[model samples]
Target: MLDRVITISREFGSGGRELGMKLSEKLEIPFYDKELISLTAQETNMSVTEFLNYYESIPVTEQSLEPPLYTSFSPLYEIPISDQVFLAQSRVIKSLAEKGPCIIVGRCADRVLEDSINLFIYAGIEHRIERIISLNKDLDPQLVENKIRETDRKRKDYYQYYTGCEWGKAQNYHLCLDSGLAGVEGCYQAVLSYLGHCI
Candidate 1:
């Protein structure tokens, strides 16, 4: 009965990566995150950085945005380097899931595997300045907070463009967690328990 797949989408500063890693270890399954990005790069014969840039935002034309037409770009317009990477990565993800159970982090995995169990995590302190300072000892709190905000904006924009869904919206996932509330280890266990029930 080990035919379940788990997809985790998270906000910036959340310990989603850590949670995915821990859960993978506990479940004894392959975990994919940035590694999937790298693998996509390899499969598509594109550089990792190039794939990352195209990963989320494919260019759209002005004509497509017209009020009357409200037309969307042809699927080919989404065929830039990163979009192709996503296709390759998605194929890999499907192959992995079909082969057995696995955990995927980010890369719009929830959307890619819409039928699979999806969990979204958002871990942010009300005061990001403090969280940044705690997470990165070398960086100043103010700078870290600024970085977090900027990074989060990019992630949101990317997700919206690629998945046609708002990032961090609770409705997008089966479970939405706050790492700051659950703590990293607790979140890990929560995911495991969630999978147990899902199976």
Candidate 2:
């Protein structure tokens, strides 16, 4: 049977979102990326800005020390805000997957969807730096590189914190594509071909 859900986890500036959009168009399925933020905000009765702040902010313990040691006395509400947002989004991802075939970009969708086809997209640091600089012409090259590194680190940590699995590992995904080598369109086509063969 055709896989109804495709989950893409990508490195910063790897064009994975672009590839996901292309695949959605070719496959005639809905694509979700930032749209999940809106859905999550609505579900939690929080504004988009508030949701983003919670979503992007890593827990304090995760930054400066080892994972926190929570005592049995701690209540569920005492959980880190980032973890709460992740759990909320996980619910949204699962609900969307149950709806039918769709393309979900990031938000740990691969880990959340039990039957989805998971793809990891990544590129070299140099390639990512160049891509970020090209997209943001006004920003300094060094600044762009720093931003890329920081964003990638945050994403990696977030994925690992939630899933207890290393992000971007080939073994964690069904297919891993190098966007630097394949380009966006090529990556999309490769995923489509792979899905065809598997389905």
Candidate 3:
């Protein structure tokens, strides 16, 4: 049986990927993040760009924009093609879980593998703009703020639309982290400690 499955979810510029990678090394488990999307694209015969365009963004339904009053001619309410692709992604995630313990990052993976011994971690910073600036030296504050906000919004909408749950809620995860507080290695150690205790 698989020992555990770790899902690292994050706000934009939260260093979740870095944390996931380090944790994977410490735990000696495979890590899946962008690879999940790439694998799904290969299985579905869709280009990565095409697959990402629809599912990676905020679903139109969740936005504050006014809904179309009439559906006579519009197919807006119909499921986007990415939903089908996500089904494929979910299958791949399950397959990996069956293979053995692993760490998965951001594809609604926590919800996808909710039945397993799951460890859900979220990383964010109180001063997101400054954190982004520090992490990415060349980017200006305005651009970083806009980019961070847009990416987080997309992730939030995607998780809510796909899993029917609010994104970034503490209840959705086993542990929540602030990179500014824990730093990458500290966050990784926390996850290790929890996994050691639980798994």
Candidate 4:
């Protein structure tokens, strides 16, 4: 079922966003990544920077802070900024999905929109380190690896927190590709092949 939507959930430095744009072009569909942040900002009258920081993250509760016993009763203001941003982004994602087919990267679009083709891109740690260095020269390899793991952990926690599904689990996605093994060109071809079979 080509639902006219593709959601890419990926580990940091996995080239997932790049693959999303590439697929978007080949499929002649709109691609949304950072554009989602800007759109959410406009819809919520919030700053793009705010969404950038909190969109996919679960807010940290202070020491001794208690979890809400009755979340439905709490006013929106009582909600954490992270939750607010997620709600705004979810609204934007669903609205966009309704308009037409598109490729949405990150921001938990896979979980937010039902029946969309979900793909998760990931690579080995060493491969990710090299990829990260290729894009950003002059970074220390050790630090780059650290950051990559950190970001992936954050994403995993955030996804699980919101969706109760483990991140990067094969069962949670329609397709899981190791971009490190299959270069972008190869991954792109695989996606086309998958879609061809689906149709």
Clashes of each: 0, 0, 0, 0
- Per-residue error for 84 in candidate 1, Å, reads 2.5
Clashing pairs in 3: none
The 0-to-1 C-alpha lDDT of every candidate, in the order given, reads: 0.70, 0.81, 0.71, 0.83
Q: Give one digit per residue, the lDDT tens place, for model 1 in 1-199.
A: 4467778887767777877888788778888887776677777676777666766554555533311111223563454444555567767777677877888888777876757778887766454455556777788766676777887887787677666788888888888887787677777777667767773
Tens digits of lDDT, candidate 2, 33-98: 999988988866788878888874557754533443322223546667666666677778888888
TM-score of each: 0.80, 0.88, 0.82, 0.89
List candidate 3 stretches off by more than 4 Å. Answer: 58-79, 117-126
The candidate that achieves the highest lDDT relative to the unseen native structure: 4
Worst 10 residues of 1 by lDDT: 64-73
Cα RMSD to the true fold for all candidates: 4.1, 3.4, 5.4, 3.0
Better model by lDDT: candidate 1 vs candidate 2: 2
- lDDT ranking from best candidate downward: 4, 2, 3, 1
Question: CA lDDT of 81 in candidate 4?
Answer: 71
Ranking by TM-score: 4, 2, 3, 1
User: Could you tell me the lDDT of residue 44 within candidate 3?
Assistant: 64
Candidate 4 lDDT, tens digit per residue, 10-96?
A: 989989989999998888889999888788888767777765676667879773133332123346677777777777778788989
